[model samples]
Target: MTASLSYAHGTSATPLLGETIGDNLRRTVEAHGDREALVVRSQGYRATWRELWQATTDVARGLIASGVKRGDRVGVWSPNRHEWVVLQYAAARAGAILVNINPAYRTTELDYALRKCGVGVLFLARGFRQANYVAMLAEVRPNLPDLRLALTFEDDWAALLDAGRGVDEAVLAERERSLQFDDPVNIQYTSGTTGFPKGATLSHHNILNNGYFTGEALGYGPDDRVCIPVPFYHCFGMVLGNLACTTHGATMVIPGEAFDPIAVLETVQAERCTSLYGVPTMFIAELDHPRFAEFDVSSLRTGIMAGSPCPVEIMRRVISQMHMREVTIVYGMTETSPGSTQSARTDSIERRVSTVGRVEPHVEVKVVDPATGAVVPRGTSGELCTRGYSVMLGYWDDEAATKAAIDAAGWMHTGDLATMDAESYVNIVGRIKDTIIRGGENISPREVEEFLHTHPAVSEAQVIGVPSEKYGEEVMAWIRVRAGATVTPEELTSFCAGKIATYKIPRHWKLVDEFPMTVTGKVQKYRMRELSTAELGLGKAAQIKMA
Candidate 1:
């Protein structure tokens, strides 16, 4: 397992780092002054370069008036709205660390993030889907002693806007001041799988550089109109959607609420959107929508799918039905500013469908043997490692954990198991920690999950290893059947028998109505393990069962 290096097909001398996202946005606004900058169609809100700058400044001034200072943490808990983008730029201009809070977070989750970040101010929506954000904040206010202001999108916005009056001139002057590119710009908490969330400290250079490289990889330009259905709280939206659009002076069309397949199609058609970015689930929903064929989606030129493995069928439909010219699959964790490798647009269809594409420009990726810490050769599966300008500064207030994930040589060890092909395309096999060993044979849970997804009755599936007496572990699966469909353990076992090895087939199955998921929509397999062990009453034996 010796590590080797392979450079990207094209290389350039351009620096991969930048001063600040705000600086880059200001330059774009100056160059494309009258151009449309952002469109929040649901709210009937649109901002050109000039109007966006003014609004950003107003928010910055309001922040200052509310006692925010450089390096202070400002938390935003809202859906994908125009104000969310305004808050991002305003915090950058004010030198405050923007902390994105998932709108779906419960009271306990919100309290934990707010206290962990020591957030001084919070911006929230009044209510969405029965979660009254303002009420939740009020409930947690007593516990969060550092919080000084609670501004709402519905109630307190006007007052906050009025507060921006006297400080307008000062805000403009402050925006002109030089900012350190390496300074921490935001803290994005990882979607915790095993334990509590950990904040990944991303610097201005980390995020801005990632945006630049992503935009260049997609060949984005001033006239490009990108549709963003992903939530703004995630790194995919912040870097790939917002920062990339700003860097290229591209128009960003945002849908402010939960994703609806019909709405997404309409937005693309009406806006003439050239690009779209979403998770695999989003694409699946769009493709499965009954009226999918009714819309004219020929305007869609390119798209980026990530967060989970996408089905090959979905990719095919994107090209054939939606007339997509390029569909790239991106892979990375929050610690890498969420952009490590992407499938190139020019790659062959087989390569694009089989892998997660090549490493982006100025980024280094390596596959290392998990047990020995040695780099694995090409075409071998190992833990993926990445090093680049986009690597996070560290976990906020968690030195030991940060040191464990990021090495002294600057490579961030992603806990994903993957193999690099001869052409440098990385194919994700499974998570290093999620791999199941059954009867002395290794099984990839992702492989089983993908196979299960192809089943007509299955809507979603999760596999985990549980304890066994004869074998070290046995395969166990929990599946969510599609509406009006029925599936049994024996039938699924029969289906997998010839398609995969007998040992990889699940010996036990649980048909679940819904899966416990994290805020970001990731299935919580660790929780499933606990539930299965408790219900089976097999004690330690149940813990070793593999799925």
Candidate 2:
């Protein structure tokens, strides 16, 4: 029998939606006029589809009145709130490119995004937690000649909307009519692990259809209420959570401004939310909260656990304890509208936990030899690549980087190493660039990390390659022990004895309160390497090579 190659494409009878975001929102409102559309617990806001349309249109008009034009960039820097949602649709309706500014960014990062994108108008919250956005903007304003205006959600938000009263609806309608489905509508910065961040530019068609299909994969409907605790700046929240809910006419429930375990549990119980969204760590926090049993989460039937590969044990616990029998694992990056594959509601627990499912609707995914770009045979590990309508137009204003990422055939070369089963399920092994070469043997840190997760005292684990004089590279683990649990490195290494290969076992260990991560919850392994090398005085070892 011929072995299956690592290539799969998704097909469905349902045609892709060609309309723009505004057009889709109008159709949804027409169908579910009186149905609940949005519920913001932090702001005590609730709106039906009709009311949401009105508010969205008002904000769209507000953008036009503020002199935003087609192709102009408008930046939104805030946490998850009603205003952020309003601005997202508003920018789409006004034909402006919505630039998502990470709320956690300081002056340097914020300044770079604003100037790079040439943002004409900026919408921001006064402050989020400890970062005072207003002060940071003030510090960076002088260098941003392209920033025509700045509007704060605290005081200027109302006035900005009121400014629309003077603008006619016809003007907004004309702008919306001019928008093509392929027109760029959003720009999101990828996590700059190695260098400065690059903006991933997405179109109306790129995101809207992806969102619709994501909801379809989850079996979402008008009756489903989705609790979204993830940050809107990431595609997981905006495209998957908000856009998914809106495209399906489902109600969007915001637990809080930021992720709060207590708030998530309370909101889920109070709203009887049918679905929930979070990364694996977020779910872990909710499951391990001291008051975990206080709230009833019986309504949760499905959701997504992604951003990183979820431990199999945690997946089982979430399914059994959280009542999320249909919860799936999604896999992708910001460049691919953030999801190339997702498990189905009917998939077996093993399939859902072990793989990221098959290719998503209208998307083609393949694992190829990293150097040769040839499709790999089943069970052979290679770099995963995806091509589809969902792929971003390119990195914003950086054609060189864009060309380097998306090849001539239009496949986005994801630097993730993965394997495909004969059944077509893809298992992400680790990052191709993250593979550790110890004593000339290849080791996947994810493999060791997953094994560490099985340890009773280990709550979280991040394994990285540290420089070694003799071996050239050695495995080091950073662990977060379970609260009230005592563990030492000696105990952990002893547990690994006779269980796994000697080289795969971590040679050094450090206990950490938390792993260094991006705002979107992705671990920074490069940072870990730098810190570990410096702390361990491995400078000379880093320069050595295996003889």
Candidate 3:
């Protein structure tokens, strides 16, 4: 839908749809000057709104001085540091599109993303662990034809700030003159599993409005301190972790490096963090840590969990042991500003645990049969389609792919298979491309996979839930053994005995050498399915004698 189209679903009380993100930030800064805006715990840095406004202005001036113009692309390739937040605001202030490049990217991956986005300036960390970002940039320099400036976080930050001296008024006026609410603010690339990554162009309004809605949904306020361990490169970090807190005048605690459960605990205790945002794997790791019981995490109130389905046991621990007010399960992709459906705090435990919850305010969702392109009846599985203000402005320079995803009615057809229950809560069953049709019964691999993960010995599991000639498709399990542990195929089968149906049980099991993964670490089930089908001939059928 066009930016002027107001009503999407629950967006009735939202502010004017046409306002720009920078304008909103400017207003927030003006209103909450003395309030602390960000807390960089690693650097021992805290900035009030007034200080953050000035720093953002200074960095915007520095970017302009470095030849970054309006509509140009600037890449921020760093971990969860103050600079990452500064660069985002600075780029927004200058009307430059910020390209989020994951800090975990290596030379090859970085080259691909930088070249694809045609980035003009890169703000990078000098070095972290084995990643020498400066050295990697030097390697990519030859191929990055549009790249003009390399600003390192360590040695060049002071010099860049110095260059902005005596230019605040000029830069602020320029920012006001050039900024527009509809301008593209960020180009977030999706982790491509099937093909090359697509850069989803998010408008200034798209992200800002989403942040505001998220804050409202979670009941955030000025007194709340949010712990943000998710990387800023991801939408979870940018929209929910950073912008959500900033919009509400809340304090954000950034740890600056990879997540350590102990470090996270310490930060939460030290900062008195009241909320947290993380993926399922992150929480699983934190709960599984040996010293988890020693930490006092009583301060946390609420948070959002995504990336995968959270188990019921883990949810219990989060509420019983950690004492979090609520753990909301959110589902979306890079295309929809990364939030479409969210579990409300008041939802029943069955709804919260079994479904991903209802569509967010101002978002319209439908389940349509992929082949027929017709809306399905409630509770019938189909491709989940979404249309909303947060829907992205198409993939960068990939019109064909964009057209394939978004239709003429503005509905973006998410590749996920799902169903809406009587309460309108959406339950994601599986990826449309990953469905397993065994014996004419369409099976969701996620269901079987989640059930199998409950097994104690199974640290990680993937169910290619692939095609069989006799049954049409068969369930195959590829498992990763826990360290210094062993489980045979029969034992794993027995583990699923009472938990899942007989057909859902994997007919064949293989201990994988290593899982093929995407850049963001999601297991590539398509590849695993291919390997399974190739290794175990699916065409053959076994004759069984019925008792």
Give the winner by lDDT.
2
Summarize candidate 2's per-residue lDDT along 343-368 as a digit string, tens digits: 99899999998899999999999999
By descending lDDT, how would the candidates be arranged? 2, 1, 3
For residues 1-547, what per-residue lDDT tens digits would candidate 3 score against the true structure?
3322211255456663466666777787888889888988888899998899889888888887787788999998887789889889888988899999887788988898889989999888897778888888898799999998888888898888888774656766766677777789999988766566789999988888788778877888888888888778888888987888888888888865766677788888888888877766567667777788888899998888777777666676676777675768888988998888888877776777788988888889888878878787777787899998889999988899899989999999988988887667889988876777777577778888778778877766778846666676779888876556789999999888877888899998988645775433456776776677667766433332111
Lowest lDDT sum, 10 consecutive residues, model 3, at 1-10
Evaluation by lDDT, superior candidate among 1 and 3: 1
User: How many residue pairs clash per model?
Assistant: 14, 0, 5
TM-score quality measure for candidate 1: 0.93
lDDT by candidate, in order shown: 0.82, 0.92, 0.80
Work out the TM-score per prediction. 0.93, 0.98, 0.91
lDDT of candidate 1 at residue 228, scale 0 to 100: 91
| Candidate 1, 175-229: lDDT as tens digits | 5484688888899888766567899999888888888878877888888999998
TM-score ranking from best to worst?
A: 2, 1, 3
Off by over 4 Å in 1: 1-11, 168-171, 454-460, 480-488, 511-514, 535-547
Candidate 2 residue pairs that clash: none
> Runs in model 3 with CA error above 4 Å?
1-8, 16-18, 166-168, 456-460, 465-473, 478-487, 510-521, 527-547
Model with the higher lDDT, candidate 1 or 2: 2
Query: Could you tell which candidate, 2 or 3, scores higher by lDDT?
Result: 2
